[model samples]
Target: MRYRPVAFGLAVAALAAVSLTTPAQAKPAASSTTMANTTSAGTTATRVVTAAIPFGQNGDIPVARNYSGDSRYEIAVFRPSNGTWYIRGVGAYKFGQNGDIPVPADFTGDGRAELALFRPSNGYWYVRGVGQFTWGQAGDVPVPANYIGDSRAEAAVFRPSTGKWWIRGTAAIAWGRSGDIPVPADYLGDSHADLGVFRPATAQWWVRGAATIAWGVNGDIPVPANWVGTAKADLAIFRPSTGAWNLRGTSPVTWGTNGDRPQPGNYAGDTGTDQVVWRPSNGTWYLRYRVPITPPPPPPPNCDPSYPTVCIPPPPPDLNCGDITYRNFKVIGTDPHHFDSDHDGIGCES
Candidate 1:
């Protein structure tokens, strides 16, 4: 469901979103993107970014890249109609045209991902840092992964006509039948992704060298991530029919509605994975993203050192003992406030 464009309305019909492609609407306040709403499970999430996708072409999915190596993924939306890309945090970039499926990933073993595309027209792959090369034929679905645990994703494809997987430098392996959706990820907790697919007809998932499970039903997209914060990736399915994400050992969450792509990532820079759903219908992305805890600010620089317990600004017009709420507090140094007139260690002595 994520690889192709389908007609479905998301849950962002009421929000007044600003279009990034067209003239920016009357700029929204800094906190405009902040969505402090709690989920049905009583989980509160805050949206930090709310950039809109291009108009007319509502088939584009928001691509996330953690090229900063900070574990925080940035959102990037690619417009297939004009080869234009609008990254929320980063600037815009155009590297591919219409019909080119965006499969950006880490391909240089740099511990980060990059913007790349797999052209289905010529069966070629064009990576940003790496050079361009050919891998599969036309109509083949792009299934890239880090097959060698090098932190770099390799080129792979799933041929629908043959129901086989074709990896770079390897022979075609028959594992799934036609109509099965290709889902390649690190399911073994070994850092290397396995070639797998989900059969909608049976709702069964078959992973190479791993156990098979029937977790999702028809019309569900496979979106795997490190949900439990362990080695292996967890099995998860985004059900568009009900707009619910079904994950093992957790409650079913209803975030985005139909036609929204599952974009699970660690956007909060926390230990758990954030469940995000980008609606291509209105170019709106709804994220079950929690805001990180912020540390308290440092003391004022002009505060006098004499009052270590409380911050007291340097005196220009001398102050009395009743100026502040301090009484019998520790007083040292020059005693700028002169509260310690008796030369005692305590200030504002009663």
Candidate 2:
């Protein structure tokens, strides 16, 4: 599995609590389009409401939605117990059912994400208006993406058993091997998602048509994103051991803990992406905006109280070979103002 989207997959199986709760009565479809093994998440409403979400009992994948088209990705969570999706700024919905893997994406290229699901039990995909279709079998990881650059996300899955990727109506290629996690993203700025996989065994990533790089170790979850908005994806990983997110070439951050799931996206509506973690313990979310650090303002230019007339700034600047680099400090032995009889504060005179 993977992170960031078009739509990425993470192995829920590795976690201790991966099983979903019992099935509930799914909402019926608006139209009888003949969906044999399909079900509706819930009805989409125009009314924007934020219902208070209760504590979650089961762990699920992190979801984000750009429902307002405001360029900022709102926080979304899929509660498996009730199949309800609580999205910030948008309303709460029931777009998925138990045992359904959440795959939120921009299916229409309308700049907003749609609620979608992939049921491994029946090997079917339920895209709200796109109809239910059979694409993957049980045990296949769902990796939906816009492989054709047609502004529409195609239903796809990576079969670990055979190391094959099957994109419905698109090409089917065998790229990764068993124990490799599928990482699909728009790597070349082509506006089309490319096939990639992260091998946990070797800590290496092999992207089709792209470069191969070894980055993280086992137990580290992939959290690649468009960090610079270069249209290409950045190779990143969240280390559970250190609670740090390592963006390739950038400084590692200590924003997440052990059980928190990292969800990187443009939550701040800025060019740089933000790091978000979904704490499944209580259904709480935390977003860390990747912003430039503003250096602390220069300290007050406090002159020596004894020599109040000359202010050379406190704590001083870089000290070179000559002295403390204070222009106002006059060498007491060589110059006037021998107020500093002892070698204190400023090395020199006044």
Candidate 3:
């Protein structure tokens, strides 16, 4: 997954990580308090405040955000069961910089996605399973997808400055022209995700998969999901000010309000992605589902009896003091000791 950078002034940097453990326990059903509003058209819109990223195979959505007003970063997994969303496996990374985007992918083909970030301060990309790599290009937006035919996803980015797409998977490919705001999906229906970009100035989407054509107008953000139930990804755009969504093969509908972030995912394992929005103002997530999703079976208890009072901690960040080599580990915690050594604000350089 990829994200647009947020503009904000920075303070001094620090790195820290927190680990927790807990005892085994039965999972609770997922439930949420929903507020429903009837539109003029008589359609009832249900809004649930859930702060999470897109859902993965395990019904877990990994969310990352800057820790308060400090340089630390926090990442956690949100699991939806029964009718409630549970936040678990929380971890923190110490060396997050302003304008950094946390991108999670299964770079090692481990069946689990690892969290990474694009640190603007060093002009490099960092992946938990794959360490730091030089992405000296300008407009380095972290765009993760399966550009290769492999089943695993890769750490990729679209460089608007050069209109090029770069993927660091089993192999590296740099192609395409200058493009803005990448919208990756299975555009070709080939099972492998393809790359697309939306030019906000012209409100057009340039897709490069089954066919290359420009579509849409006056779009601000790209919302990709399996709207047609064809198992292939489709495109949509959200007009933030108006809270209207223009789906390529569907009529326009209003779902969110201003200041809501688009986060589309297949939260129910239905193979169909659902539209989601995260409003930072209240840290709530709103989801709109086209089809009813059957909740997944609960996972087995993983609590450690010996450490009943200890909280289960998520994986640690991949950091090597003085070694610039890219190590595969999730980025979390603060670097108060300057473990990022060179003081470039990026912890493990090599």
Candidate 4:
């Protein structure tokens, strides 16, 4: 979200609102996917696709495919909805759509949409949808590395419009390749390549590109990076709305050798963005990347018994609870009244 103030003849104006709308569809319920157990907080987590998605040529239509043997895919599930998606029939040399792209059982979103494929033989993997016949590699395209003739790249496409997802590519430290995408040549490139989309509870253009994006509760975007097989790689989610990326957490994978690449997919986890689900090459699911986590610092040690009142920082002088004496000036009484105004147990103006 980029905002700037403009000074006019006698007023200050904030430019806002670009109109773009999709034709109304029957309720999102009209074209919902069958979900077995979809209830939340005692209520039903109904599927809702409120916007018009230009998914290739099909728009809101759904399609299916099949696969063969000795082949594997990297699939990522949509958070909570409990859906799974993967890339099938991708050859090391080119892209083919003949294989099955299974839509997870619980996946009930607006058109069942997966990601575009990136086949090294063809140079790169382009994004394509159902309605459209050709892939749209013009603006955003992901180009990963090729290790030992086998492509070592992974990708997961969440609700792209959510603006909380990012792509990461890991190559051998020696594997150096720049991911190139088309940019406006004449624009002078004032913007950075860090781009993403987002969806807010009540805001327009939350789905931003090359801009700050944030997510709900555990909302986060995936980032692609090159990491070593032996060491762990730290990753931070980018917040486009604030132009800040934070080290919300880290991920470490036992990477393959120079020729081995990490397979990417959406892992099933607790139905929120706060949880991370990564599927390992063995097809087992993990809650986090294998790495040491730094536990939070221990709370300041209990005040020393001999010196009860020790000022911290502005550095309170050490005062002994046993030796510190208090004299009441404001209150006069036959009975002694101390500084413990609230009177919990301590007898001084603590």
Name the candidate that leads on lDDT. Answer: 1
Point out the worst 10-residue segment of candidate 1 by lDDT. 6-15
Off by over 4 Å in 3: 1-95, 169-179, 212-214, 290-350
Off by over 4 Å in 2: 1-60, 291-350
Give the better candidate number (1 or 3) by lDDT. 1
| Candidate 2 residue-wise lDDT, 1-350, digit = tens | 21222222322211233233322323322222221211143322221111222323446556776767888987667777666666654556655577999888878788777778888887867665445667788999998888999987878999999999998886789999999999998877888898999999999989999889999999899978787566678999999888899989877877768888777888767665777777777665666553333356998766544444454333335333254444444332322234345656444444
lDDT of 4 by residue, 299-342 (tens): 87653332235311111443333454542213222212233355
Question: Taking the tens digit of each residue's C-alpha lDDT, what string does model 1 give over 1-350?
Answer: 01222112111121133345543433322334444444434545454442333332376757876757788877667777656666665566656778778888887778777777787777777776456777899989998888877777878889999988888867789988889998887888787998888888999888999889999888888888876456567889999989898987787877778877888887667655777777776766555644533446986577788888877787887889887887888889999778888986888988
| CA lDDT scores, all candidates in order | 0.73, 0.68, 0.53, 0.25
Instruction: Estimate candidate 1's alpha-carbon lDDT, on a 0 to 1 scale.
Output: 0.73
lDDT of 3 by residue, 172-239 (tens): 44444564678888877887887777776676666774455455556468777666457677777777
By lDDT, highest first, what's the ranking? 1, 2, 3, 4
Model 3 lDDT, residue 239, Cα: 79
Deviation in angstroms for 92 in model 3? 4.6
Q: Which residue pairs in candidate 2 have backbone atoms (N, alpha carbon, C) closer than 3 angstroms, thus clashing?
A: 1-9, 2-9, 41-94, 41-95, 41-96, 42-94, 330-349
Instruction: Provide the lowest-lDDT 10-residue window in model 3.
Output: 78-87
